[model samples]
Target: MTDEASAPGKSTAPGKSTAPQASDQYVQSLARGLSVIRAFDAANPVMTLSEVAARTDLTRATARRFLHTLVELGYVRTDGKSFVLTAKVLQLGYSYLSALSLPQLAQPHLEDLSLALGESTSAAVLDGTDIFYVARVATRRIMTIGITVGTRFPAYATSMGRVLLAGLPQPRLEEYLAAAELHAITPRTVATRGELLAVLDKVRAQGWCLLDQELEVGLMSIAAPVWNHNAGDVVAAVNVSLQAQSVAAQADPAAYLESVRRHVVETARAISQDVSAKHGDA
Candidate 1:
């Protein structure tokens, strides 16, 4: 069996990331191993050996080997005829949480932002072509779209992605842009390089960004970058999302945008000082 570094969206059954880069001799084994785990998804959480083999594109014997190895490691388990995930799988994501000290640090401020603004708030970092939601505080449960931990969305269409991207070095930002096209989730989604670059420039100059239903329809968002005080580097971004109806109900997009931006920026500053400080460089 071979595992490849899984890209975020493919088999992303809410698959946080399943796509991996092509492998050499050593990484080949690792890719096959991870691929075994990714074979499980929301639709097919448990599977027989052959199902796992088909899902992973591995031979039954190979899938069994990797699956057995994972079961041995406590990350995978067998329940009757099918294989399933174990609680230990959380450790992989938890490691990132513990290492970053982000979710714990940002929760309080994020909560405040959501409550005060009567909207949803989130924090995230770039993951290839997508924005991976790290922490979220949502005021409404029945939002237009469901967002859970590990949800990935097109960065080209989100406020948080743009603000964070604005802070990236020119060469890196251009590289990402060159590889990215404006995926129009809605008519509002910027579909060309020129428009996206222009919007990104505005995000940089104004210190905030507003995305109006570009990713998810009837949902508007605003975001601001959080920077490290010591390094002066933008580490991540915080965003506020409100229902499109609500935004329109208010009768002023610019005013609401400014308000949301302020809350996001202030919360981000708190996150930097309170959370980043705990890290060695913070």
Candidate 2:
């Protein structure tokens, strides 16, 4: 994406190249390759040669070359009818998970939380405006949206995003606010920078955030920051997302979220203990 499309909320200032972009300068093949992978997602998983061209906005020939290159790299595959992804793509996400101490330790907690809360639970980190789900436990809900382990979401609207952003340094947080698009996804979406900032403050002060249909209709989530020994710096975030319909039908939203947040904190604490034990940090 042009630095203009540089993920969503985060800005790369003009003439101050924080992220590499192509122009009269130079095109980085590595960046382009990753962008190609990002372009192929749950929605656009299978694309024809022409569809890939339109989706990536690359010329048909350019798209074909990259597609073939990805095929050679074993990251993408074709079924003759259309192009699709392969399990080998998991290596990219697993590379990070394998190196991380938290995800490996907290995975069981996530599963337990999902079972207890009757909702999907995820551990994520802020990546630009998006939070990248590292470890997730899928749950069965009538309105459950299937977000795989490597899903990304807009921070300005997601429970995890706001919780994680609340942990960012002031300057970085300002940078994010200055560039956020704040697109409207639902009637309760926080599209203005002021609202986002206020919510971030409340998230920091309250130590958790409740996102009620901000990212999508019929979806509600509660997120809390995951910290290490310090309890100040947030290393990651954990969230429980449940169907909004279930919230109104079953239990009180505030009490439900409070219970879920407590479980998330306990899980994080347990994971931190495991990490410290493994790494001799204990």
Candidate 3:
């Protein structure tokens, strides 16, 4: 909802245009309406009309019209003074999820991984500058936030993001580096383009990524890229997350971490194989 990597008031739409808003294809009203929807997030789940206007940088009159329209559409509801999103809003995302096979394919694999490792496992895809979770199997609650199917985190500070970024083609990766606004999510976050590039280089060479305390204080994660049918490109990534204390409590921390990394990589490979097989049949 409130991604630290995103700049204030900037839309995180994938492939956002740098051209002027006056472009023929650019719909101002549509953009404004989406902005109104995005204004409600984890921090601000319910807001007044003026609060929505302030958050979206739209005038009260414009925000009101959109809010009323959303209410008429059953995506939003207002109890006279405040507005909140309804369950119907989830249908918008459900359409995308239902059409995507990756989540359905990866769900069982993630469940097995979580059961085996006694930790949380998740699969996610690159969305704009964020890693959007598509599937998750949680053994226990680790992070401060609840990680659901649609949770998003900045790509630069996450293991899954690193693996997905490493799988990107050179030109696309370069474009991302140029447009990405790097900021410190934590003290260990790779907040500079040059440093991030170096890390991605290693991830590309190693075929996986292990990140510690970059996204959160006590969380550690290892991730591997899920390849397409041809094994030519990464379609998604799978990861295992555990508390930092769990690794430290091990008699051999390095070996413990290495074991966890192996499991994550193996699970990713298994999922990739399934994807390839499914595609081959199709």
The lDDT leader among the candidates is 3
TM-score per model over all chains: 0.77, 0.84, 0.89
Those runs of model 1 whose alpha carbons end farther than 4 Å from true positions after fitting are 1-25, 36-84, 142-145, 178-182, 251-254, 279-282
Instruction: Tell me how many residue pairs clash in candidate 2.
Output: 0
Candidate 3 lDDT over residue span 48-101, tens digit each: 999888887778999999999999999999999999999888888998999888
* Local accuracy by lDDT, each model: 0.72, 0.70, 0.81
User: How do the residues 1-282 of candidate 2 rate in per-residue lDDT, one tens digit apiece?
Assistant: 100011223222211223444587676666556666767664466778887766556687887888889999898998765788788988887777888877777789888888887777888887765677778776553332347667666777788788889989999998887656676766878988888888899999988888887666777777777766544467788877767776777557678667777886676666656655655654
lDDT of 1 at 240: 79
- What's the C-alpha lDDT at position 195 in model 3? 97
Question: In candidate 3, how many clashes are counted?
Answer: 0
Instruction: Name model 3 segments beyond 4 Å from true.
Output: 1-22
